[model samples]
Target: MSLFKNVLYFQAGFGFLANTILLFFYTFIMLGHRPKPTDLISCQLTFIHIMMFLTGGDICLTDIFETLNLENDFKCKTIFYISRVMRGLSICTTCLLGVVQAVTISPSTSLLAKFKHRLKVYMTYAFFCIWSFNLFYSSNQIFYVGGFTNVSETNQMKVTKSCSLFPKNYIIKGLILTVSVSRDVFLVGVMLTTSMYMVIILFRHQRQCKHLHSTSHLRASPEKRATQTILLLVVCFVAIYWVDFIISSSSVLLWMYDPVVLTVQKFVMYAYPTITPLIQISSDNRIIIMLENMHSKCHKILLNMFLPFL
Candidate 1:
């Protein structure tokens, strides 16, 4: 395999592992282990990221499915549609995560505080809406994308070795582009706005804590740590997302897909999903504490076993 394939495989493997761990952690919490309000959203986000890797692997690692003898059109459309829907869900979930966190950390008297009690209900409704919208919105990919059969054809833009986007009317193509752009811009805008709100909240909170206690005595709250983690995720997602977006949009508009450009775009596209779970696992206090306890248990067991020999 080439270096690009090697890298993609490594990324997919690592991301899959990280996301699985996160999914299980959230599952454990949901199963009555001190669950929090944001656990549901976080769990959903992890699931979406996991699906992204799976769908992505399906597209890039075609060798895994050679025995199925699936038609190219079916393979392309199914994979592409699912991938697009998952991508849409990823952003929408992340955006909702940020907004929910902001609401979660708001002052008791603040306007956002009212939704805190009904947060779970709202999250459920929001999730349903998000899934429905994305499933419908990404239907366009099913119509436009297909397997590349004619190597001589210049009208279609090849996305992968086998999958290409069939040409559509310019007006229809432009409309699709506009809708996609608008959706991304709206979601990104909400994420940024909420992030700013969170930053202010954290700042004011720090000041209050400092006033109440000395700098050395003050420790970060769980809420503050969660907010910081979400903020970091938002920043990382926005940066990587725009790069991927620019490349994809440019490719669509220019009616071209250079190999090098596609490789770089793939890297950018995978970066966020790969990094997100690792960040969450590392930053979560509960995960850290659980890991510490597990380590302690292992050490104790090893010491007891060795003591008899010693």
Candidate 2:
């Protein structure tokens, strides 16, 4: 494979592994194998990311086997359709995760604080609603996109390097346009608002406690670390999301297929999926606990075997 292809595969592979690790951690929490409040929204978010990476793999494989789908419209539509839905679901889940975390740390007097009592239940319902909405909304992709060989006026048939959506009627086209734009705007807006609110809250709390310590710098508390992680996620997300949005919007508005634009967009979309889990694992004490337990168990096993030999 070429360097470009190698990068895409590696990015998708690493993201897939990260999501798997996160899923394993969340699954343990949900199954009660681990002692933690079941964070339903976070579980949903990780699941969605896992699905996104899987669908991306499917797309990548499709690119490799282009000969099979070179003249097949159905094969093209199926891949793109799955991709659009997963992409939409991923964005919605990310926004929901941000909003849930924001509310979790909201001040007791704040409106979001009212949710503190039933946070898990509320988040469960919220995730269900998000999944339902994304499924129905993105279903339009079936009619909006497909594989086709378009013959230009000069009489040459052209197969697009990347699948492109071409809605049949103005109404379908308008709906797709509106939904795509509005979805991104709403999700990005929510993420920005919630993450900033959280960062500010953590900052204020840190400031209040500053005087209690000496002039030496201190390690971040769990809350502060969580806040910083969220902020980093938001920053990475917004930077990549807008760049992907611009390239996608340009592709849609201009109806031009640029290989460079498509590749860059793919890379940008992978950014959050690759980074978020690393931050989660690094900041979470659960991983440390698991590691410590494993170390002790292994030490005991080794001692038993060696002692018996001695």
Candidate 3:
């Protein structure tokens, strides 16, 4: 295989591995523990990551098969649909996560604090509604998408995944497109608001902490670390998503049938889910404690072996 193809496999495989580890850590490692609301949401998010990578693998295979001429771009509707559904789930789960965390660190007197009583219950409902809606929204794929025939410059027959909407009603197509775009916009708006709210909360908490102590004495609490992590997650998600959105939109608008755009789209889409576990693990004290214990054991063993005379 070529270097670029190897790199593609490596990135996708690593992402798949990271997401798998997250699932294992949650399901097996935390099985004995009572699951927190955030933990449950995170488990759902991990599943989204797994699905995202699964589709990513599909994309990789499709790309390889196309390069080998075993398949063509017109044969990609399944992967495309899976990608769309998973992306939708990922975004909604992220927004839900932000809202959960925002409520988590809210001041006792704040409006969000009032929801604390039934927050988890509400979150569960929202998560279900989200995936349900997305599944329905993307179901149009099965109706409007199919293999499209195209001939190469060399007069070779090729078929790839494409919209077979020409025979369908234009009004229906427009309506579906509008609905899809509007739903995405609404989700993004909510994601934006939740992120900003979290930011404001962080700022206020920081000011209060500073008022109570010197800046040098300010230490990041677990809540603070978690808030920061969520902020990073939101920022990364929004940025990557918007960039992907713009690229995808531009491709459709300009009819840019370029391989480079597709490569970039896949990279951005996959990179976030791939690194999610590492980001969460960085803020998790349990992982840190585990690493520290491992380090101490290795040091002790090496010391015993090298300093036996002592």
Compared with the true structure, all predictions reach lDDT values of 0.86, 0.71, 0.72
Show where candidate 1 strays beyond 4 Å.
58-64, 214-220, 296-310
> Model 2, 99-161: lDDT tens per residue?
877886788988999998887788778778877887788676677565554535322222245
Per-prediction TM-score: 0.91, 0.82, 0.78
Q: What shift in Å separates residue 102 of candidate 2 from its native position after superposition? A: 1.7
Global local distance difference test of model 3: 0.72
Show how many residue pairs clash in every candidate, following the order shown: 0, 0, 6
For model 2, the stretches where C-alpha displacement exceeds 4 angstroms are 33-38, 57-74, 150-164, 167-171, 211-220, 295-310
Model 1 lDDT, residue 223, Cα: 73
Rank all candidate structures by their lDDT, best first, as comma-separated numbers: 1, 3, 2
Q: Supply the TM-score for candidate 1.
A: 0.91
Task: Please give me the total number of clashing residue pairs in predicted model 2.
Answer: 0
For candidate 1, write residues 128-201 as lDDT tens digits: 99999999999966998987877475577888878888888889988988898899999999999999999999
Q: Write the per-residue lDDT of candidate 3 for residues 217-238, one digit (tens) a residue.
A: 3464777888888888888888
Residues forming the 10-long window of minimal summed lDDT in candidate 1: 57-66
Model 2 TM-score? 0.82
